[model samples]
Target: MSEKARMTTHKLFLLPDYEKEGEYLTKMHSVGWKLERVSGFSQHFVKCESENVVYKLDYAANNTNYPEYIKMFADYGWEHCGRVMGFDYFRRNADGLSEEEMEIFSDPQSKLDMMKRVILTRMTPLLIIFFMGILPNMYMIVVNSMNWDRSTLLFLAVLYLGVFALYVSIFIYCIRGFRKLKKKYTE
Candidate 1:
């Protein structure tokens, strides 16, 4: 498949804070649309053409009117996939909330999970270099010491140091990038 066709943009719509579920149903029905309630949070998947749009209904603070909207969509025969309490990390909302709020609403556990994955990825290469390159070089150095080759020892030392520096540089870059991303999202 073409890249463009494979790439689909999923837009999130946040229902108004005080709007009743029925009101949203009325609006959607008017546009020849309907919402299908999934499970938790009164979420619905809106269908248009061949695409199913996912909606997450949150009334956390001042918007606790979801049943009405659910009824409205039910009346119109719109099918919904399922409901979920929260969205995955990749979902994007097209509401007025700022970037900071978006970051805050994002699941902290998911962020930490991603961080762990990144750290593991960064460590894998360093561990491989240490075991395969550095350890073997160290063994060679020990073996060579018995031969009393001063120049060979110096070269091995320099090579080991070079490998160590390269490993340190890579680790530093990964750590700094991870920190920057964490600061940007958390702050």
Candidate 2:
């Protein structure tokens, strides 16, 4: 027996824009690299024949009834590919299915609700840390910087600013993404 060729790629998807991640995975499958699983930021794939498929990501951080959840998706013809960091990966053959039929979400509101859940469960804690932990530390650093040497002050300034910039960027991305999704679904 021969082992199929496999590859792993690293990807970072912001919490609010997992739809893009799903699209990426679908594109990979279309190019003959089918996703086998995900671990942290690494996506593992095995070589396979090219096929038309639709991949969807759903956020459910704390689903208690694990068995039933997979069963429900199975009943709807979706294969549960894997789960990574609370995101459930599902896919189905899209060869003859309409866009409507390919959707894992049944209604616009359900999509909105999933976005909310992703925000609440995944993004919220990071935000809380930014507000409560990072902000306070930043304040203290600024206050104490007045007594520091020039070089030490410069390093701290750059480091803290970089961290602050990252948090701000994430916040902005979430706001813009949520607004776009809400408008798309609601309209």
Candidate 3:
């Protein structure tokens, strides 16, 4: 067979969605195979033939500059392969796995784990804002109350609100940026 026909290495670039990773692994397990997690750059690996298939998990890229990364990969001779859906339905259909195997792979535990990780990642910034901004504002309020100056208190309150609004706007903008990135990559 030609080299392309005999190609055994399959590189999977995983978007930073941990839930999706867990789901992919759970489905793969149903087929009597398991994925090994890797660090940095690539996230997982699967032994295919003479080489190990490298799977990169980057849930961060799901909503980041993934398109540019994909382009860079293409430039480096990596083919634009198919993507795995949240579950293994597409894989099962393509690989012709039996229904029994699919059921086994559809493990709830993996899905739950994936969900937890995704939620944690998404919430991290919000948690940071709450601690850094809201908590400080609370402290300021306490301090202002002790001083008992109405005008100073009002000014401080207004200033804090303005800062809070700015912080919220920035957060929203970042979220939009991620969504845009996702759209670009999917296209």
List the candidate 3 regions with Cα displacement exceeding 4 Å.
1-130, 139-147
Model 1 residue 126 distance off true place after TM-score fit, in angstroms: 2.8
Q: Tens-digit lDDT track for model 3 on 49-160?
A: 2322222232221535657755655564333333443221112222444444333214545434444444466546566977787868768697768776888888878887
CA lDDT of each prediction against the hidden true structure: 0.46, 0.89, 0.46
Those runs of model 2 whose alpha carbons end farther than 4 Å from true positions after fitting are none
Highest TM-score scorer: 2
Off by over 4 Å in 1: 1-108, 139-143
Index of the highest-lDDT prediction: 2
Comparing candidate 1 with candidate 3, which one achieves the higher TM-score?
A: 1
What digit string (tens of lDDT, one per residue) describes model 2 on residues 28-123? Answer: 999999999988888999999998988999886688999999999899899999898889999999998987889988799899999898888888
Write model 1 residue lDDT over 1-187, tens digit each, in one string: 5332121223332222112333344344344344444333444445433322223233222225656644544453322333343322112222454545333236765555555544554356567867897778777787778786788778878888887787777667656666765675476
